[model samples]
Target: MPVRSPYPDVEIPEISLFDFLFTDFGGRDAEPALIDGGSGASISFAELRGMVEKIAAALAERGIAKGDVVGIFAPNTPYYAAVFHGILRANAIVTSANSLYSPGELAHQLTDSGAKLLFTVSPFLDRAAAAAEQAGLPADSIIVLDAAEGYTSLHDLWGTTAATPAQDTLPTDTAVLPYSSGTTGLAKGVILTHRNLVANLLQIQQMGTVTGDTRILAVLPFFHIYGMTVMMNQGLHANATVITMPKFDLPEFLRIIADHRIQRVYIAPPVAVALAKHPIVDQYDLSCIDIIFSGAAPLDAELGHAMGKRLGCTVLQGYGMTELSPVSHCMPDDRPDLDLNSSGFALPNIVCKLVDPETGEEVGPGGRGELWVKGPNVMVGYLNNPEATAITLDDEGYLHTGDVAEVTEDGVFSIVDRVKELIKYKGYQVPPAELEALLLTNPKIADAAVIGVRDDEGEEVPKAFVVLQDGVELSADDVMAFVAERIAPHKKVRVVEFIDVIPKSASGKILRKDLRAREAAKA
Candidate 1:
C-alpha cells in the first residue's frame, strides 16, 4: 500500500514558471519583490517584471530560442531572480551551476547541458570565462550581471528594444537543469520540467503559511533546488519579500536578518548550530523570526529545539532530494508540536512506498526501507543519461530515493540516512548522519562528519572526522570516550580524527567521497 498525503491534492496550473510567478502581482506591483541584503537595494514586483521582459527581449534578439539552455553561475542576489525568470520568459531553459564551482566543474555542466550562454557576476568572471571557453561558447555569449569591463553587461541586455518572445513552452518542457550526484556516481543533470516546478510551488503553498506579508531570508544558493524552489520561487508565489545574500558571512547573515525583520528563515542544519550556540548570535535581535524551516539535511532535534527556544520561534524540518523538485514532505507551519526529527506528512499528490533495499519487499509503518516516491513533482529523468534514470526511476514511475526512511501509522515520515552512506559495523548498520547530528550537540565541537573506514582487520567501522571550536583542545581518546558512553557498541565511534574543517557540499551535505579519497591515499 502506498502512503498518500494527508492533505487534499492542490491544483497545479498548466503554464510555464514565468506565468505561474510573474503574471499575477495585483497590489504587489509597487511592493518590493527582492532585496539585496548587502547593498540594501530592492526591486519592486513591477520593476523585476520589467527587467525580466528586457532580458528576455535581449536574449531573443541575440537568437536565444525555445529549447535553448542558458547557464547561471552566480551567487544569491536580487538580479539572479530576474535573470532566472528572464531565461524562462524567453522560452529557454536554465542550467544553474554552483557559484563555488571551479572552471572544470562549471565547464562540465555547461557542456553537458549544451548551454548557449552564461550569466555571472564580475567577481566570478575568471572562473566563468574559463568555463565558457572550455564549453566552446563564444566570448560574446558571456553576460555579467554586474558591469564588467569588455564583457556584455546587464545594462547592455536591458538596452534591447526588441519584443519579448511569446511563451511556447509546454508543461512537459524542461525548466531547470540542476546537477546532483545520485545514489552513487558522478554528478549528473537532474531534468526538472516546468510542470515539476509549478507543481512544487502549489504543493508547498499548502504546507507553509507564507503570505504576502512574510519576509523570506534566502541565504542559500539558488543553484541548488532547495534554494531554487523552496526559498526563491516559493517567496515569489506568495508575493513575499525575498532578501538575497551573495554569500554566507556569519556577521553579515545575522545583521541582514535583524535589519530586514525577516519572518520566515529557511536554513540547512549547519546554520542552525550557529544560531543555537554561537556567542555572536546574542548580539542580534532575531525575535522577528516566526518559523525556522530546515531542509537539505537531517537536523538534530535537540539543536532545533535549542534554536527555537533561544529565538522564540517554531523550528520545522522537511525532506526531499534534487530529483523530487526538492520537496515532497514537510511540517506544516501550524504543526509546531510535531517532532522536530520527523519531516511531517507528505504534500498533496504524492504517494510513497517503503521497500526493503536488499529484499525488494514492501515495508509498512514502523519498518525502515528505501523510500520510493511517486508524484507529479518527481523529475521526468536524468538529462541525457537514460541508464542512470532507469536505475533510479522504476516502471511504476516511482523514484527510488536512495535514502532510507520510516513512517509512523499516523503518516509521519522520518528520513534515516542515505542507503549508500550507511556504515556496516559487524553486519549491524550504523547511520553516519545520526552520529554527525549527535556530535553537533557537543559544546566544544563546532562541526563533524562520520564515514566508515577499515580497521586493522579490514573490518568496516565508524570513524569520525571532527572540527573543534576555535581555541578548543580535545584528543581523539576524549572524542571516543564521549561517543562510547552514548550509543550501542556497534554504533560507537571507533576512530577519531580532528581537522580544521569538514568538507561539505554547497547544500551542506558532507562530502564523504572526499574523505574516502583521503583515506584511500593513505592505503
Candidate 2:
C-alpha cells in the first residue's frame, strides 16, 4: 500500500535544493556560506559553489551519475557541506556516517546503502578504510579528506575545470539518504529527494524560528537528519552562519557561544540537560542565546523551564522520527508562552492526528494515542525495504510515529511516551533489546534488561538492570566496561545496578513503564 499524505494536494512548487542553494534565495556569489568557531575557518558562497562544482565534475569523471550513493564519514566541518551539495549537484545520494561509529557500525551503513564513494576525515582514517573494505566498496572509490596521504582531497576538487551539473533542475532527484538510528532494529536508508529537503527547510523556516540575522550553534552532528535538515539546510536556506564542532564538549560549547554571540541553538535533549544542570554553565555568558530547541528525545517541562530560567531565554522542544525528515512539530518561535511540555503546533503544510493504538481510531483532542504524521516532509519510503516501509508508513500516508502523545484543543501537543522501546542517549537512539542481546552473550550475565535513567542533567542514559549467574561475581564497573568496547559511544551503558528479577507482564514482556516509575521514585 502506498503511503498517502494528509496535507491538501496543493499545487506547491517542487523546488530542488540546488535551486534553493544557488538561485531563489542566495546564489553562488553571496556572503560566507559557513564559519568554523573551533578553527576560525570560513567559506564564502562563491567558494562553496566552486567546491560543489568540482566534486560534481569529479563524480562525473568517475562514471557516477543519478541515484549513486556517496558516503560522507566525517564530522561537522565545512567540507561536510561541500560534499553534501557536491553529491546533490551530481544527482547522487548523500548518506552520512556518524564520526564516532566503529568500523563494524560504519560497514553496515555503507553496505546497506550500497555506497559507491566515501568521503572521510583524517582522524577516523583507519575505521573508514576498514568499513569501506569490509563493505566491499572499491578502494579507488575511497576519497580521503586530505590530499597529503595520496588520497583525493575534496578541497582540490574546488579548482578543477569541469562542466557544471548537466542536469541543473533537480525537483524530484534524490539528494540525501540518512539512516534510522536503528534504536529498535537494523538501520534503514531514507531516500530524501531535493523536494523533500527543500520542503522541510521551508517548513522549519515557516514555523517562524529564525531570520537571516539569526546565528545558530551547529553542535548537533550533521549526520542525523535533525541536524542535517534543521541546522544545515535551515541555516543555509536563511543565509545564516553555522558554527561547526567536531563533537560536543561542554567548555568548548560555552566558549563558542560567547565568542560567536550565538543567537539561536538547535540541540538534543542531552545538550539541554547539560545546560540546565551542569555547574560550569553558570560561569559562561550565554546572554546572546535567544532561542533553544531540543529534540530527538522527550524533555520534561520542568527541566525545559529550568533551562529557560537559567539561560533567560525561551526553550522549545520538538518531537518526530527519522522517517519524517525529522521535523513534525516544533514550538513556534512566536508562541513562546505555549506550554513547554507540548512539542507545539505542527509546522505549516503538516497535518498530524493521534490514533488509539489498540483500535486504530483517531483520538480527539486531549486524548492519548500514537502520533500519526502527514506532510510533504514525510519520506518517500525506506530504500530497498518495502515491507518495513509498509509497516511504518501506513496506506493513508499517516506515518505511525510510534510515539504516544496528546493534542490539546489549542493545537499544542505533548508526548507522553513512545510506543517503541528505543532508548535515546544524549539525543542518540540506543535500543534496549540490542544491548540486551549483547549482554546475554556474557558468561557472567544470567538475565539483563536495559532501561533509561535520568541523570542530574535531566537526560536519559542507558542503565542496565541485571541478575548475574550463580557463583559468578560481575561488578557494575565490569558490566559498563563490557558495553563500552562493543558499541558506539552513545550506546554505552553508563550505569549498572543489580536486580533480582525484571518485572514482566502476563504475556512475558518486560514492564518498562513500571520500571521507569520505580526509577523515578528512587530518584
Candidate 3:
C-alpha cells in the first residue's frame, strides 16, 4: 500500500502563470535565475525580467498581437525563457519546436500552427531557415536568437526598445500551444491556456515535494512542456536557481551538482538509467543532492531505489501527459517507502478515474482501465481539429487520456500502457502514424511500421521494421539514413530490420506491443 496524506481536500487556487513570472519575488533583483551549466553564463532576476519585457515589447512592435502564434526554436538558454514569457505576456501562443528536428519535421509544426514569427538560435539557423522557407514563412518573420559571440544577438533588441508594460493575460487565453498526439494519431497542437499551466504548477507544489530553498539541476530541454512547466516554471516560481544544460553529458551533469550544491534534480527515466548504470556517474561528488523526480517515461523501480542508495537522495516518479499541462500526479520526496511501480496518487485539486474505454463506466479501484483526468489543468482541446478534440474530451469535460492504468486502494496510480500509437523517445512523444506517413514517401519502402525499442541508454528509440518491395535492395543503413533525413533526430529510426510483413490485427492496426516484445526477447 502507498502512503496516504491525511490532509483534507483544499480549494484549488486560481492564478495566472504569468503573474508568478512578474510578481513572485517582490523585486529580488540580483539573485541568480538561470545559469548555463556548460558555459557558466548566468542571468540575474533583474536582468531576466528586463529581457522578458524588451522581448515582449519587440514582438508587439512587430505587430504580433494577442492570440497570434510565435514559434520558439532554441535549446535551453536564458534567452529562451525571456522569449517564452515575452510571447505569453503579449497573450500570444508559443509553439515550441525541438532544436534537433529536421527541416521537414520543423516545417510541419510551423505550417500547422500558422506561426507568424520564429525565434531560433544560430547552430540551427540553416535548418530553421529551410524549415521556414518550406513552410512559406517570409524572411523578415525569422528572428535569429543568437546570443553567443559572432552572431546576431538577442541583446540587440534590448535598450533599442522601451520595455512594454505587461499586458492583461487572462486565465482562459491560450499561452502555449505544445504539440502532442492524442490517443494515437498525428501530432496536434494542444491548446494549453494560462489556467491550465498555472493549475498544474500549483498542484505539483501542493504535493509538498519541492520548495523555494531547493536548488534544481535542469537538464531536460525546456522546449518540452515537462521541463518547461514542471522544472523551469516551478523552480522560478519557488525562487530557486535553475542550472540548465544545452545537452546531456553525464560527467558535467554530476559536476554541476557538486559545484552548485544542487539539492533537487528533475529528469526522465533515461537520466535515471544513466545515474544507475553509467560508470562515469560515480566520478563526481553528488553528496549534496537531496531529491530526484523522474517523469515522461516509466522508471524502473529497482534502478530508482538503487539511485537513492548510491546518491543518498529520495527518488520519486511522476506521471502525466502533454494534454494535462504535463503533470497529473507526483510522489513527493519525504514520502515513506513508495511503491517502485506506482506513479503515486493525484495531487491536491486533481480528479482522476479509470474507465472502460468502450463502456465509459468507472472501473473499481485496483482494476485496469483507460485513464480519464478532469481538472483545471486539462487543456481546452486540440487546436483547430474539431474531431480530435471531440474524441479526446468527454461531454462532461473529462480528458480521455487513453492510458491503461490501475489505481491502488489508497489512490496510487500506475500506467500499464497507452492505448495509442505513440512512442516516447527519452521524454519526447514520437507518433508512429506520422513516421509511417513519412516512410511511405521512400521509393524503396513498400510498407513500414515504427515501434519503440529499448536502446543501450535504457531509453526507447524508434525502430523501423520494414517490408521492402520486390527488386528493391535496401540495406539497414540505407533505411536508417532515409528516416534520419526525413524526420527529427529523435524520431529517426535507430535500428532497421527487414521483415516480410508488419504484424497487424484483423483491422490492420499495427501491433507495436508485439514488435516491442520481439525486440526484448531478441535482446
Candidate 4:
C-alpha cells in the first residue's frame, strides 16, 4: 500500500532545539563552528554556546518568554547561529523573515506571526524599523546584530546573567514558523514543532553521511526551510564547520570553496546550472569537494552529471517542501548505483504513497500520481489557518505534497510535475495569485493571469498575461516596473504579454494549462 524508507529508523531525542544542537559539543568546542565567507571571521563552538545562553538571558530580561515569537530578518552570518539558538534557548519561537522582502512584505509576516522582537543587522535597520512600526512593534524591540546608534548590540547581551535552561516544552510545541504557499494561494505560516525539526535532522543524518570533519558551504538563504534545516541545523548537529555567504555571487562562491577547502556543498538547480556552464569555474580548484547535493527545485540530470564531472565530485538530489519540515527524501552518499535523475528514496521512518489524482486510486510501481507522505517530519499545521491546513494534511496524517511523482519498485521517487500553481524563482516561492493581485492594482490592466515560464537560464520566472483596458496602451517595461515597486525582487514579473481574453473554466478558475501551452508554443 505504501512505500517505506530503505534505511532503518533513527532515534530522535526529546529535547529543545538549543539542547539538541548546543549541548553535545564534546571536545570540538574549541573548533570553529561558523565562518563568515567574506571576511574569514569565525565563531568557535564554545563561544557560540556561551553567546546563546547570554542572549537568552537578555531576551528574558526584555520580557520575552516561552511561546513568544521573535523575528530574525538578517542574512546568513557567523552570528546567525547564536541569535537563532538564543531565541530557542529563551523558549521563544523564531520566525525567520526574508531579508529581501520589501517593508510592506516584511510587515505582513511580522504582524501575522505576532512577533514581539526583531533581530536584524545594520544595513537593514531602516527597513526593519519601518516594518516594526507597521506591525506595531516598539522601537525598543528592534535589536541590531551589529551595534547601531540607538539599538542594542549582541555584545551588550553577553554580560547579563544567563537565563536558566528552557522550561520543559512539549516536543509538539511549535519551534519555527517559516511561511509557505502550501498548494496554491498567498503565503501562510507553516508550523514546524520541535519534534518535527528534530525528526528531520535525525532522518537526514541517517540518509546521508556527515561527520565532525565535514566542511559545508552555505550560500542558500537561511530564511528558506531548505537552508535552515539542511545547512544550518544539520551542519551544527553533525559538528561541521559551516561557511556562510550572505548572497550568491559566482566568483565569490568559487573563491570561498577554494579558500575553505569545503568538502560538501548544498545547492539548488539554478546554482548547479551556473557551476556547469559558467566559464569562471575552471579558474578555481574544487578538488576538495566530495559531494554536491541539490534541492529546493528539480535539477536536470545531465547538468548535475556535468557539474559533478567538472568538479570531480558526486552529485546528488533531494525533494521536499516547507510543510514537510522541508526534507523527506534524499540521495544517500553511499548509493552510487542509483539513478541520478531520481530524487532518491525516502528518509528513514517516512511512508510515501502515490495516488492517481483523477481516480483517487493508489498507483503501483511504474505508475504516476500525486505523492502523499506521512512522517514525524511533517508539519503540525499552518498557524491560524485551519482550513488551509485541513486541505493539506488529511485526517489520516498524510500531507498532500502537491507534487506529481513516480515511484520505482525499489522505493526511489522521481518528481515529474507540480499540481499547484506556485512559481519557483531560483528556489524562492512566488505565488501566481500574489502577482495577479498586484497586477490588478495597475490602472491600465483590466484583467491579468500570472504563470511561471522558463527563461533562457532554465529558471522559472513569473510571466504575466495582461488584458489592458480598451483603448489604453502600456509598455511591457512599464508593467514590469509596476510590479517591481510593489513586491520583492524574486517576485517581480520578468516577462509580459498582452492578450485579449484569458481562458477560464466554468467555475471561474484561470486555465493555467492553456497559458502554459501558449508559452510552450512560443518557445
- The most accurate candidate by TM-score is 4
What C-alpha lDDT does candidate 4 achieve relative to the native structure? 0.91
Please tell me which model should have the higher TM-score, number 1 or number 3.
Answer: 3
lDDT of 1 by residue, 16-58 (tens): 8998898898589999999999999999999999999999999
Report the C-alpha lDDT of model 3 over 123-227, residue by residue, as the tens digit. Answer: 888898899999999877777776544433566666455557457777788889888887778878999988888777777777755655677888888888888
Question: Which of the two candidates, 3 or 4, achieves a greater TM-score against the reference?
Answer: 4
TM-score of candidate 2 on Cα atoms, chains taken together: 0.90
For model 2, residues 1-523, the per-residue Cα lDDT tens digits are 1112223343346676876766644443566667887987888777777788888998877777888889998889877888888888887889988878889889989999989999987777889889888999776778866664767777666656778668654677777788884325566788777887777777777676575677888889899998898888787778787888878899999999988899989887667778999999989999999999888877778888999999999888887777777788878788888888888888778877788888978787868988888888788888888887888787878777778988877777889977877777777878888788889989999888888787775567898999899898989999998888877898899889898898889998888888888887886
lDDT of 1: 0.89
Per-residue alpha-carbon lDDT of candidate 4 for residues 211-310, written as tens digits (9 for 90 to 100): 8899999999888898899998988999999999999999999999999999999998889988998999999989999999999999889899999988
- Colliding residue pairs in candidate 4: none
Candidate 3 segments exceeding 4 Å error: 1-15, 147-152, 163-166, 455-458, 503-508, 511-523
For model 1, give the 10-residue run with minimal summed lDDT.
422-431
Best by lDDT: 4
Clashing pairs in 3: none
**Per-residue error at 222 for model 4, in Å?**
1.3
lDDT at 212, model 1: 90
